[model samples]
Target chain A: MSDDARDEETVTVAHGGGTGRTRDFLEDSVVPRFGGDADGLAVGLDALDDGAVHEVGDRSVVVTTDSHVVSPLSFPGGDIGRLAVSGTVNDLAVMGATEPLSLTCSLVVEEGVSVGLLEDVLDSMQAACEAAGCAVTTGDTKVMGSGDVDGVVINTTGVGVLPQGAHVPDAGLSPGDKLVVSGPVGDHGITLLAEREGFDIEGDLTSDVAPVNDLVAAALDAGTVTAMTDPTRGGLSTALNEMARKADVGALVDETAVPVRDSVAATGELLGIDPFDVANEGTVVFGVDAATADAVVDALRATPLGAEAAVVGEAVTEHTGRVVLDTGFGRRYLSEPEGEQLPRIC
Target chain B: MSDDARDEETVTVAHGGGTGRTRDFLEDSVVPRFGGDADGLAVGLDALDDGAVHEVGDRSVVVTTDSHVVSPLSFPGGDIGRLAVSGTVNDLAVMGATEPLSLTCSLVVEEGVSVGLLEDVLDSMQAACEAAGCAVTTGDTKVMGSGDVDGVVINTTGVGVLPQGAHVPDAGLSPGDKLVVSGPVGDHGITLLAEREGFDIEGDLTSDVAPVNDLVAAALDAGTVTAMTDPTRGGLSTALNEMARKADVGALVDETAVPVRDSVAATGELLGIDPFDVANEGTVVFGVDAATADAVVDALRATPLGAEAAVVGEAVTEHTGRVVLDTGFGRRYLSEPEGEQLPRIC
Candidate 1:
């Protein structure tokens, strides 16, 4: 009945912020209806992980879906097409399914969009799939009357296969595990925000929207990745808090070691935003055994996409379900974002 | 270069009509990019079939995705929620994958929609999934600023499995194959149109929107189904034309044999729309071996969802790639509906 109480209220933008409010909405409104764990599922809606792992006969089938409603359609470094494909692929990658067996795309377009735009989007999608070593095998397209939808909203679903019992969960971390990041965070969210607001930052503010499955596969090959997740909507801070809470551990981040582009940091400071609380399209966070953390970072750095990899933090025994930031001056608790500071960024 | 010629043109409602225009756009823009056949695909984008069949190791994986942007979200018999789930389920069922292994949902909602409305819609989706014996294992949610989206648009992707070589393609029909229909057509399209236009027809004008996977499975078990497709967008005419063209054969239909509800026929006449050219959410068309056509019809009729199943036509040796209808008084070619006469009907 408590869940039903929220039904009377209208949806707020913060409900989809990908932070505490988002989780609260999901737990109250969605989880009760169909999010409970189901049989044949290694990872179901209850886990709220990157993707769901279904145990088929001798194969672990990973499935994930994302709806990209990014504003501006085209951005600094990538467009909606690349973001859509990479989002689903990364979700699968984080679940230990680096090779996508199949991908499906569904497009909802507003009337009057130029065919040239659609073609460009499709080309971007094709190129991204090729980079991921996959293809769009099935798709559906619907056109709404003008203003019924934004310029375009894309939904992509990815299916991948991993060896049985090989899939990873975001909640698999244990105390004393080292936290590793594939690259600089907040590039995507900050770039899109700057572009939308017409802010001209000096340094490179391009979005880091690329497929990171290859980077993930290399890391998985090098070390024991107890847990993995992409810092997407709510950025590194939200992802770290989720991992800590789900694993019943705490995280202590060395702020100096976390990768951040100078331009991104400057823009965040100017805009009164935290780089850690934004989004990164082509980045991954790993909870790895302390002994193999350096090896995992080295393996990631070997890849073009993960050249800026670093060990940013560690899972700790104290302050379970919290994230503590060591800014090198003093330690402070890093809170999960309460609402979306920048919506429609991805 | 010819494909690029259309790039300069703006997208019209006809571009997404699920008819000749839609096929042309796909061939010109999409096919050139990624619709070509790929390795390890039993049924790929080129086929434009119900779904794509990926040869995964030893098992055949069937994947399909659909975006539901039906206007007036709730209709006479079903809402967008049921339509979304049933649409994906039927697509997989037509491909010989009646048992869905996983389903993913992605929702794009306007900022001010009521949570109560979403709850009702989710309840409908849950019931539909339960009917299809599937679960929503993974999903994503995004909220747009008010007016960026109409209300809520749902995209659902279904992943299913059949034994390798067991899946069917829409182009598998042959000469002498019997054509069968699950039940009366035109209900969904006519009902939606009536609701949109505020026409108070004096009869049961309900949309036949239900998951028909069980009926399809029973029919497949009873007879040899060489080809199959569900009539969702351009209705039975478009589906039959596609089957004939893909198989490089002709079809001869007995107009009287096609089942259309009396009220639907009356409504179609009132609106100057052909019943055969309107959509039916829960109806299926089958190309069966003539020897087993009677048994297949019987099996379908035994199910509550297919009590009106009937043999409507047969593939013929003449008039290659065309469909001819015998009206008892005369005969004429049945053309694919040129554009969506009713936009956003599905």
Candidate 2:
């Protein structure tokens, strides 16, 4: 069970999340063992952008792959189908790709799954594709024996075309950049946890699972967005730390300025999970020019998915390659979650 | 477990193999509900080619997705990682895309598996990618509980560039096109089965699992290749019949002309399976212009993967939408395998 895993004997849930462990696993074991050391990578796994960029003759294409094994195929605000489409599309979106041209889906279904359930998931996928203005041009389906899979595993690969040099990466952040979050954080993670743990609440707290490519496009077109990332598995803190390290700059974040929905904040506190350490499916944190940060936030606020956009942090050169938190009382360094916090939240 | 399954209540292995039951299941249950309806598809699922073709701005791209779940991860001559890459690269090749540019791999690994085993598989993938001359540009990894999945599952999606109007489809076979097979058939299918079922074989027999893009390129460049498809799950019979049905042309195949290795033929006979009805991972059956069929055969024979290339059949106008076999004993229509003759052969 052991080969190059840092502390654990085998893979842990943190390996799938946006944490240092995932990076370590990829770097120490995967990157060198496999020949991932080629040239002309706009954003390789080391920099860890939302998507990988490849330069074609006259156009730069964004490609991203994601596997959705979210438990309880259907949830409060969305299902695995919606999550699969939205998640892949957002990866392309944060890379400054406005419209994803094509997507290829491969489904691994368990033997005993009902035909009706499969149809329902397909319908959800169709709806999500329509919302994002992307088409599922090719797909393959395979059914596994009952115990071979839990229920279903979906892998969606998306391709988005961009103008020759318009694509962005996490390393594009500079010292004078400002960090803006598109919407409230931790709603998706908290909602999934509550549903899985049977936490009843008065108001409906839905998963923040929606495609944000349109919002990203509007913001990129209207202002100067140097770099962007969508926080999914490892939440806001991990994402910010990744960007900061990639650009070799320090992040000065104002704790009070971070946007968190009331219900999500309450649920996160009740569960003993930090809001900034949880996942968000529909939000993007952008590092933009400080002078145009206000305009970028305003442009994002006009989009349906970004009404709560707010400036939460700024890139600084003081503590290079780190994320510093400025709370109301004192200051601290925001670090990545050490171990597995949640699993199968897509 | 029931919704629209014709007879069975849930999905079966027959749905994974390229059988009529799979077609019926897709048509009756999937297509009518999932909205696969659209236009500008040179080869869609209805035609049942190896991949789908899409025309972008000034170029055409071939897209294919396959999920590899071969048992025993490691086999006689190849492993799951090699199968994943070769299977995907071959799909793009037979669709008139002889050079695939990029591939995206998403892996769903079960917990408790050894990290050493994972590294071995990744090494195989590296070798296969080098052989195919394609880069795995984007990837995702997710881990599931021990009992949720059977070790691991890999989904690879490939994208290939084609000359603007040079793409081929299942319906491209004309009345007089010749059917040429590149290399021997059933080696891969028989080898996997023999290893899994413990059939003792003499004199070094292994799965013929290799990428054949170079051979396809040579043939396409030298002669008129109207349509082509790699014989994978349902083998030569299924592939030829699919092209016949799509093009509304009858195929006349001579049993004596089909190329089969002596070892594979003997193994298929012992196992009570028809050699032509089994899969071949590294073989392409081409429908080409009859006038230059011999030239196409010579060009294919020059490549390493096409040493035994031969002309096996021809498209005819009579008995439209059917395939007729002439074995010198008598004549019979070659129908698709009724049910799951070989499960997980791909």
Best by TM-score: 1
Q: How close is candidate 2 to the true structure, as a TM-score?
A: 0.95
**Chain A agreement with the truth for model 2, given as TM-score:** 0.95
Model 2, position B346: C-alpha lDDT score: 59
Best lDDT goes to which candidate?
A: 1
Enumerate residue pairs that collide in model 2.
none
Question: Model-by-model lDDT, in order?
Answer: 0.91, 0.82
Poorly placed runs, candidate 2 (over 4 Å) = A1-9, A33-41, B1-8, B29-47
Scored against the native two-chain complex, candidate 2 gets a DockQ of 0.54
lDDT of 2 at B240: 90
The two-chain DockQ for each candidate, comma-separated, is 0.81, 0.54
TM-score of chain B of 1: 0.98
* Per-model TM values vs. the true structure: 0.98, 0.95
Model 1 ranges with Cα > 4 A deviation:
A1-7, B1-7
Report the lDDT tens digits of candidate 2 across residue range A109-174. Answer: 887787667777878888898899877767777777889889888988888878778988877889
Tens-digit per-residue lDDT, A180-221, candidate 1: 999999899989898887884684789999999999999999
List the lowest-lDDT window of 10 residues for candidate 1 chain B.
B1-10
